[model samples]
Target chain A: MSLRRLGPVAALARHAVLLASGALMLIPFVWMVSLSLKPPGEIFRAGFSLLPEQWYAVENYSRALTASPLPRYMLNGVLVCGAILSLQIAICAPAAYALAKLRFFGREGLFTLVLIGLLIPHEVLALPLFILAYKLGLLDTYAALIMPFAVSPFGIFLFRQFFKSIPDDIVHAARLDGLSELAIVWRVMLPMAMPAVIAFSIFSIVSHWNDLFWPLIAVRSEQLMPPPLGIMAFKNEEAGSDYGPLMACATLVVAPLVVAFLAAQRWFVEGLGGGVK
Target chain B: MTAGLTFNGINKSFGGAHVLRQVSLDVASGEFLSLLGPSGCGKSTLLRIIAGLERQDAGTVAIGGRRVDDLRPKQRDIAMVFQSYALYPHMSVADNIALPLRMRRLSGMQRLPLVGGLLPGSRTTQAGIAKEVTRTARALGIESLLARKPGQLSGGQRQRVAVGRAMVRNPAIFLMDEPLSNLDAKLRVQMRAEIKELHRRLGVTFIYVTHDQTEAMTMSDRVAVMAEGEILQVDAPQVIYADPANRKVAEFVGSPKINMLPARFGADLTHAAGTTFDVRARELAGTAGTLGIRPEALHLAEAPGTGIFTGRVRLLEHMGSDLFVHLDLPHDGEGGTLIARLLAERAPQIAFGQTLHLGVRTGRILVFAADGRRVQPDPAPAAVLRSYA
Candidate 1:
């Protein structure tokens, strides 16, 4: 074989390895969907087959849809996540611009504080935040849900890196053209940081929409509960694990995220890489 | 259309490092003044201070006899073209050019993305902005690139767009910070001429900052030679060349650079090559100064006498019009190579290692004190001294 012709073989081997790993990742998703469509008796049965012996897709989906307040949970999820993300961008972009470009006193020290914030886990703040929200009479309200997540240290750091990558001349040019500092942030920096915003948006939506811990502590009302808390309620109210409807709820809860990711997977991936540029 | 700029007692420092020190300059209305200096000489910082982009540690910047210290950069009535061009990457060329007009003319509510279009009179305002953008683009010969983003255009095209952006505002003062430094040499030369023509047509005050001596010398009405955070000399291009105020100014202005050799002015008044001239400074007697001569002032001589220096030829560089002869001089105290620019037609046959005599003309010799300030004789030397002296 010619040396030039060996290129295809190398490419073929690369694809084979990739395909194997991809399928490995897909197995759990396939099994979850398969299990959700099975009857309760079939879930515990040891058959290793991806397809259930009998189809209960319609029955399980109908119960998952009607037997609980799934729509309300999804609605609450959307509202809370949307508010959190909007506030994150509005608050973080200016902070990042200040951290990256402005030369105020203690600027470097403040940026160090932000970097240190990234190392801390949000779970560590859960207890104190819950107590504070309780003291402020904010528990069981959307304010408790959204207000705490408004300022994101990671978002600030990401945006600061992205902002730093832009040449200072571009920002100064905006100022020369009569833009105030806020106008420079929104009109110039935000538009240029859209990729990062989208990337961060997905991250924010995924993490917060799926969040159960904070909502569990903050909410006592069922209507205020997001998807994770709502799905847990389905388990307790249905009087057991009742694997079919529960898995169906899990499938429904995860489907929106998967679809969103698939819709903008390219931007999501590029958004992750955009900060370095 | 024009206003003179006066920079009085400008001082600046960054992190304890003094960048500009008591630098002062005066530029007449409609005059093109270039601040010429090496990098880190604070030329750009001075321009920024004038533009209000930087705040001086202590100074007063007045444009057209008006104090603008309380005003911001936008309120200063000055537009600056940056070295990077600094065009908005996301905005179309038309939008980039329209931005200054929009910011100055439109209210905050009229600039919103979707709702701004619904407001009454915004349509006509938008139309006006568009028309002005088109007119400016046409003036700059970039009408075809209006729809293109800055990233889509070439460097020269982007530069024209940047200039077009600055021109649309019709500001009284235009500041440019080495705007041509980013272009290739040929394009830089081409754009240099275009900018000069633009300055002529606009007739506005221009304070341009550049480190390239050729750019400053070829383009400005007055060139300020700066070093070590201060302006050493400010004069017309020809005047700056013919009569520099100090040794540093002379050394920085020319192409091959001015030549300097240590010499005694009171007793031994000629170059240190053992050649002699009738010394004439009664007050400068027994005082020491260095002899300065340009490369053009030195001519190939037949013998070593009367302001002549003899040295072996080190190298010969033949530019199309002139031959640069590098001579390694024999010395009493100072030692270095000397370059003499001789015309190609007048240059004698030359070779390496051949001893040559260089004669500096009488009036062309400039003497500087030990501190590098230009020093003149108290009594004028005989204007017509023969080589026989």
Candidate 2:
């Protein structure tokens, strides 16, 4: 079936607007890449330029790799994001299933409380979380970086909507087939909810990987710093003029996520509507 | 050994909406019973209660002479085929059929992914499950489809896989909730016959639920008709259709529906629906009632002024074997129209707007009171004769 009807000129006009929007979305990344490839002095000299006059790509990338604990920061970023995403799924999936399917007394009231959580942004809780981490002696530790994001209300809500779309008969059939509620969650519902999980994985990993606010406030040591905080600190300590290595480090830090997203984009894009199909 | 199942005083409510009310039923072992009702009539809910999926608010459910109200669904030794088939899309037909057996026979560790394979004795249990699955699949004639996942199969194939799953358990009872509703008309008929034969071959208690009267009438040993959360009648399919216990059951079980004409019963003669016929009324003569006629009971007369109903043909629908005649009565008060199912060969070049006289056979008229309960008089002649000859 045809989804749209457009005359050739009208379609051309629509494509023009969409192309401009697409270019606009990519402009910052383009500028970052351009600055990363240019000689260190040319970054300061450039008013606006798409390409670098002299390619310092090898030197900038090599230096970015060698400089000041950047690799270790990337490793820590992976560890923190992986831990946070896995923990978020483990905690929220069953909770989401219960919220979507189970018939407890205060199910609605509890879900309302979780919905209210969406209104309270992470920024609102950052101060209290910092204080709590400090009191717990978790400052400068991976726990502080990973622990605050262990339960995402958005993840729970997304999974709950996805789980709700699954027919209740399948769950009842599983029950009659001798599966416990937990077995139904992991073995039955989880497999069916893979698309939702993939979509949520993208959300969790991207958000936690690029997060700078919590990491800057929580970590004091360079050893445990995530890439964003590490690169920001690297800029402060490095002679303020070397913008090439900084952008290159930023590129290195963000590349894994961009590549991973591109690899899984088909399912991620289609599955974002909160269903398997 | 297979055993009978019973629900005593079953009642349930969702918030303030009373869904099932004092529903009590008993099923003999090896009997195929159907709970036929329209949507939201609590037939599905009652079926779930029988399967131990839904808990009754105040009732005792007994399976195999044991009260199973406290038991979990798995403990109840019953299996169900959902209307949606509920086949795990990720699992192959073989795995879908084997799931129940594996869960029952294998330990949690033995059921794991990689570690389960390495565990001792897991191989033997897995082999045994495969054998049983193959046997069940072969029985359902779906052995060729066992290797494919449910997503790859058609609706009828998925239905067979579901039955194979339930069949593998060898449970004491089989509960099916409109299992054929998803299929088209031709497939529904074919699957209905298969289900009936399956019930005969299995010799286990089968409780089926559906809204389709044809399915219930054609397949079940007995049908329990329900409406508004209460059972109206429970009888053999033939009996339920021929002699429904109430107006609701009578109206619900027939195609084109039973033509019920509001009438008055007095002096042992029925008068209404533009036709006057003698009928024995169980109540007093002054009582208001309905005169019910099945479509087959009405036949075309040779001429007007000779038949009970004289009217103009409003519509005609021709089936290959039979024709449907819709007639507009002469004096229409509130009685809308009379519809008759006649053989195509018997209809004489009938057309819309043609005047026709219709005659009802003696002993074919059914009577109901103003409150819509069946009222049969002594020495009634219009009741269906169950021929013993």
Candidate 3:
């Protein structure tokens, strides 16, 4: 009857909605785990249950590991993501520094171009990038996989915003102390913007590790395929899909990112929060 | 290693708005010169031009009789302590102080992060730099803080570290852009003395920019009063106070502020605030001007008569040593307000609503023309004709 007493009911309602949405997001991952541990007969069973009556986790995991080089795919994912993240930082940090600190002609226009680059989806650039790769004879190679995502507009935007927040006094101080412009980026701006860097690393690793589209179009060799493409090898059209091994591969592929995100959750939040601040 | 600095017609503008307009100043070697002004007066901009941080659109900066317009900030042989004490947040205080030396002493290869320490000859250079950093830190009284990051130190300690960073290189000139403005009042006074002592010990030309008149008056050998992209006056601290070149300089350099009364000048007499005096300035005749009187220049007169201003006492502020008496003038005197400072013990009985006549001695009144330039008093007459009010 009183507004003060209605506070608890309102809070309960808000938490209930949040929990339901959280459950909705988590159901598919839970189902995948359940299916990975179930025998083939139970995967398509009518009754819904969390755990498999018969434990076939070992069999399903072994098949997923050996059937299509799932471990090799995860390794490839690490290599490709590592290379992309490094190249992105190297290219983006200086570009962002220039856009944020330096005064020059056409600077706003160049930054506008970067904003435009953010608006255009990577899927839209696939055809042109694929043709260029073919012309350059970079198809079916790690170069093709690593090169396309090297210059990330979002990374540049994130770093530029972060660099802009830093006072101009520091930049002037560095110059007076005999630091070159590039050295300022390496020694000063990068260290000061560490939170943004960690946040960007997580974003790049997650997006590229799970990226299926570009790798599918560019690389044909199973040796060079990233995790998403490697997992696609589990699907066979001739026979109905093998749900057990497929779900096992999906769980394995998503596991590293989840663990990494959990470990770096603090820096991740600080990094994104720093961008807005 | 010390040098004089000269700004020759320096000019700068941001987006078509002029920030510095043909501003020129000369700081003699070993002199402590302060660029005193309100904010946005382009003092910092001029200092930056000297440091080669910001390029002026026109004019050249010279140091030690050599033109340095084409030189970089590092090549200019000058150092600056920024207002924010812009110490590198990540680097320790030792590393921060050692940076200018390292940049000068080490090759690009030897300055690399991990492998540079292993480079041949770099070890010796680094040892020398370490010795220098420690010496500079000790001089600044921050040797114990060498291992701490700037974020861990108090504001005063950080300012000392910034000064140490500048002083380690032993440059020709030191340009400080309001370095003391960030400290608390007590700390500011303490550091003010320390900085003055540092200047005396180093004997380098210091171009300190500040908006605080007290800092300028106490520390600077000479002060250049600036306003709105122009220098109004440049003289010694005492001369700047006693003999300001313009009305702006008179109003800017004092704490309680010089009181100004609007006046009209006749052929041989000046009339102000219902009182007329035969202080002759024939060149300023037939024009309206301002009569500038400092608070200490005013004294208590016994009664309202010639050579005295009569007003009703509005307020009395007891300042321990001196009492400030605010007076409200009559309607014919343009309803002006005046403040006269009296020795507190001498004027103990002064109360609100009392009528007082304030008198000024001869030659104490500063006359300014309509354009704010000082109007020289006539030198021929040593005589003062008291006001026939």
Interface RMSD of 2: 0.5
Off by over 4 Å in 2: A1-3, A45-54, A237-239, B300-307, B332-336, B349-355, B380-389
Residue-level lDDT tens digits of model 1 in B89-152: 8899999999999998888999998999999989999999999999988888999999999988
Candidate numbers, best lDDT first, in rank order:
3, 2, 1
- How is the predicted docking of candidate 2 categorized under the CAPRI scheme? high
Question: How high is the CA lDDT of each candidate model?
Answer: 0.87, 0.87, 0.91
Fraction of the real A/B interface contacts present in each candidate?
0.78, 0.89, 0.89
Report how far off residue A80 is in candidate 1 (Å): 0.8
Model 3 residue B285 distance off true place after TM-score fit, in angstroms: 2.2
Better model by DockQ: candidate 1 vs candidate 3: 3
By summed lDDT, the worst window of 10 consecutive residues in model 1 chain A runs over A229-238
Interface RMSD after interface superposition, model 1: 0.7
TM-scores for the candidates: 0.93, 0.93, 0.96
